[model samples]
Target: MLEKIKNNFNTQTWVLIPIAIAINIAIGQLVLVLKLPVFLDSIGTVLVAVLCGPWAGALTGALSNTIWGIAIDPSAFPWWPVAAMIGYMAGRMAQWGFFKSWWKVVVTGFVVAITAAIVSTPIAVYLFGGITASGSSFITAYLLQTGQGIWSAVVSTSFLTEPVDKITTAMLAFAIVQGLPRRTIGGYPKPEQVEVEGGEGEGGANNTQMYIAIGVVVLLVLFAAFMLRNILGG
Candidate 1:
């Protein structure tokens, strides 16, 4: 099974990789059409993670949204990789069969959100957090203020939004992957290519080009989101 997967990676990555990346970016833009509170594009990141595993997911997630951050929230630019990688890890965990049930998926979603928050909170606080009286406001305004440092503000803000983003994204990814027709990643597999004699390796997980494709996708989506958000005042 591993051998087959590796072969798939060796062969079609160059071609399918770019296409997948494009699809992911376009999907991210399309998610904007829904205007959900959570970022639905995380679904794409998760899907990549689940199918191709962590590396692709991480690469794709970090890249696409990192650019998005730079373009959209300039102050939050550093967080793009943080968000994408979190999504990548979450999706990878799910694909490892961590989210077999609906409730499990929800829990996984929350887990991802919290994980993202934990990973990103400190960086946000140290970098751009001192922006307004936001941190001090937490100390004075919010009742349960432990303190007001980079950690507090980052954790607080992330706690507010990361869970929502994670849950929504995980749920969405679960549904999409479940619904997708089980075939090769590229599409209906060629009749010439029979299912190898082993357990299901990631349908097209072997494709290395897939990563390149995902990377391209990440860049394009970030660019698009950056431009679109600016235009729409999002």
Candidate 2:
């Protein structure tokens, strides 16, 4: 296991981690500033997971959240495990060939989101009394007021918020990987993990897939908005 984990890191992977961490922190802070409902913070984490490996991805996620917490907000310090799992799961999905196409990438994103939700629940429940500083915690607070258990409220909030953000993050990461030069990508530890499934010749099909991914993200955003409306309107 250690050997497998070690193989995921090369000089390029090492170099990528810090950049990925910066991306995570910058986007996360931007979302916080904008009061966005979704946290698009894990794009870099998923990118590293797909391009490097699970271990490296996990490291990037952990460090990203840690640095963000230390330098920006103390509240973020406790969620490093959730961030790490996001990276780890994204990497595992890529290793399993899920990163090779737009639809599979969506699946990867959903899985990562679920992992994040599950991992974050305990932290939210125990560390912060089922309410953190995030906007999503409003959902948890409302659920608690309605007499839901703390775990249920936190988990429900996570379920409501995680999928859309994570799926979007994965798709964006995929787009970034597609946009990068082949030579630059080749320097990464697992460059082949991100090779488009149908090859570049299938441009039309790839375009269709991209559209589907975009449509899904739009739908998820609308769903989240609807949920927020219901929660607030209630």
Candidate 3:
């Protein structure tokens, strides 16, 4: 296990971690400032997970939130576990070959989102009382006001918010990896994890997959909006 973990780190992996952390903080802070319901913070974390390894991804996620909390936003401190688990789950899914194509990347993202929701539920409940500083807390607050249990409210909020953010993050990361030159991507610990399985020389498959992914994203957005309207209106 130690060897497996050790194999994930290389000169390139080390270089990428700080860059990933920076990306996480910059985008995360921007989302906070904009007060967007979806957090686009984990794009970098997913990037590292697909390229490097789960441990490296976890480190990037944890450090990303830690630095963001200490230097930029204090509220980000308590959510490091959620971020760490996102990274870990993304990397594990990648290792299992889920990052190979755009549709597979979507699956990876959904799995990571579910993992994040489960890991975050306790923190949101016990630490923040089902209301963190996140924009999604508004949903949780509404649920609570409607007499929903704290845990249920928080989990529901996570289910609604995390999939959109995480799926987007995973797709974006997959696009970035797909755009990279073969030689450039080869330096990563898990380059095979992102290989376009069907046909490399041909371009049609990638485009089709991307289009399908976009359609899925649109449907998810509509579904989330409908759910929010119904829950808040009812």
Candidate 4:
């Protein structure tokens, strides 16, 4: 087990971790600045997981949140465990061959999102009284006002919001991997994990996947708008 874990790391993996962490932080802050409902922060975590390995991915996620928390907001510090689990789950999904095709990647995202929801619920309940600083906590606040318990309110909010963010994160990461040159990808520790399984080299299929990812993002934006309207309008 130790050897297996160690094998996931190399010079390339080490080089990728800081880059991944930076991506997480930059995108996270971007979303916050734009007041986007979805976090969209874990793209780097999933990317590292697919290209390197779970442990490396987890380290990226943990450090990403930790550094961001210290540098930006102390509130983000408590959520490092949730970020770590997102990385671990994404890496495990890739190991299970779930990151190859667009559909499988969606499933991987859904699974990771569920894992994140589960991991974050307790923290939100005990730490923040189910009222996180996140915009999604408005949903939780609504649910709580409807007579739901803290756990239920938090979990429901996560369930409703996490899938869209995580699925998009996974899809975007897959697209990034697809767009990279083969030689550049080869430097990663587990490049084989991201190799397109069949003849997706055809331009048409690649375009379709890109469109699908874009479509998903557009739909998510619309849904977020709708949700925000209802949440605030109430």
Candidate 5:
């Protein structure tokens, strides 16, 4: 187990973790400021997960939340576990070859969304009474006002919001990986995890997959915007 953990980190992984953390914080802060229902914070975490390995990914997530909480938003402090699990699950999915194609990345995002919802439910219910600082708290608030229990409300809110956010994050991460040069990707611990199908390790296939991922990301963003408008309008 120790060796496995050790193998996940190299000079590139170490360097990437800090950059990934910054990405998480910057994008997260922007989303929070916009009061959007979706949290597009974990794009960096997913990026590290696919390029490095699970342990490295998990570490990036924990650190991302910790710093964000301390420096940006205190409410973010308690949710590190959810972020960590997102990283771990993404890495595991990639290891299972889910990151090799656009469709598989969507599945990975859904699974990660479920994992995040399950992990965060207890935190949201116990720590913040299902109404935290996130814009998605509006959904929980609306649900609770409708007489749903706190646990049910929070979980339902998460299930509704997390999928599109996570799916978009995963797709963006995949697209970024696809855009990276082959030699650069080779420096990572798990470059093979991102080798696109049909190209068999060549750049041509990855370019096509990356374009598809970007298109899907744009569509998800529009869908999220629509959902946000409805949630906020109601």
Candidate 6:
């Protein structure tokens, strides 16, 4: 794991981060205005999770959400990390093949969506309500405009959104990995020893590098979309 961590920060990975940040910001803002059901923000988190597992996912998630939280309200400090954690968990689950099948994806979606709603709604209510004692006004306006109780609206949104976000994220991550160079993914599957023996090791580092580079690139794309939305537009 430590070795993997060391490798994850290779020159290529470092280059990708800032570029990804810029792209995510742009995309995130555009999507918000377009009111797309799919969110590009969580893709970086998902890629991190897929490539480096949950820890990487957590970092990606937190950063992405923090940027977004600042846009929503400066007082939403507490909620950012929480939301990021949720993003991390979703990515981790997807990595575990939670979305391997359509049925599985549907089931995973239901579970994640509900959990996001339960965890996220109250925080939103609190934050939107002026962060004061009488949060009643904030809650009232939210509910009135939606024509549903705040809880219902939030919960429904969560249920509907989580699946769309997770599935798309998972699919994108998979596609990026497939498209990347081979060494980038796993060091070439032992190409050196494969001298007619098998393509087991050595020589294929280049392929692995490509896979890694591609994965890193995908992560950046996600980050750029998110950053654009939170900073430039917001």
Which candidate ranks first by lDDT, i.e. highest? Answer: 2
Arrange candidates by lDDT, highest first: which order? 2, 3, 5, 4, 1, 6
Measured against the true structure, the TM-scores of the candidates, in listed sequence, are 0.60, 0.93, 0.94, 0.89, 0.85, 0.54
lDDT of 2 by residue, 51-151 (tens): 99999999999998899889988888899999999999999999999998888988999999999999999988888888888777778888889888888
Each model's C-alpha lDDT? 0.54, 0.89, 0.88, 0.85, 0.86, 0.50
Q: What lDDT is reached at residue 147 by model 5?
A: 82
Better of 1 and 4 by TM-score: 4
The 10-residue segment of model 6 with minimum total lDDT is 189-198
Error of 1 at 214 (Å): 29
Worst lDDT run of 10 residues, candidate 5, spans 198-207
What lDDT score goes with residue 81 in model 4?
A: 99
- TM-score of candidate 6 against the unseen true structure: 0.54
Measured by C-alpha RMSD in angstroms, how accurate is candidate 6?
11.5
- Can you give the lDDT of residue 184 in candidate 5? 98
Cα misplacement distance, residue 47 of candidate 1 (Å): 0.7
Using TM-score as the measure, what is the rank order of every candidate, best first?
3, 2, 4, 5, 1, 6
lDDT score, candidate 4, position 132: 82
1-234: candidate 5 lDDT, tens digit per residue: 999889999999999999999998888778879986567899999999989999999999999999988998787899999999999999999999999788788889889999999999999888887889877788889888878888888987787778888987888787788889999999999999998876355543455665776676668667767875776577
Instruction: Count clashing residue pairs in model 6.
Output: 39
Q: Kindly list the per-residue Cα lDDT of model 6 for residues 139-181, writing each as its tens digit.
A: 3345347467666755544443454555545445445544566
Candidate 2 — which residues are off by over 4 angstroms? 32-35, 199-205, 229-234
Pairing residues by index, what is the TM-score of model 4? 0.89
Q: Which candidate's TM-score is highest?
A: 3
Model 3 whole-model lDDT (C-alpha atoms): 0.88
Q: Give the Cα error of residue 145 in candidate 3, in Å.
A: 1.6
- Backbone clashes for every candidate come to 6, 0, 0, 0, 0, 39
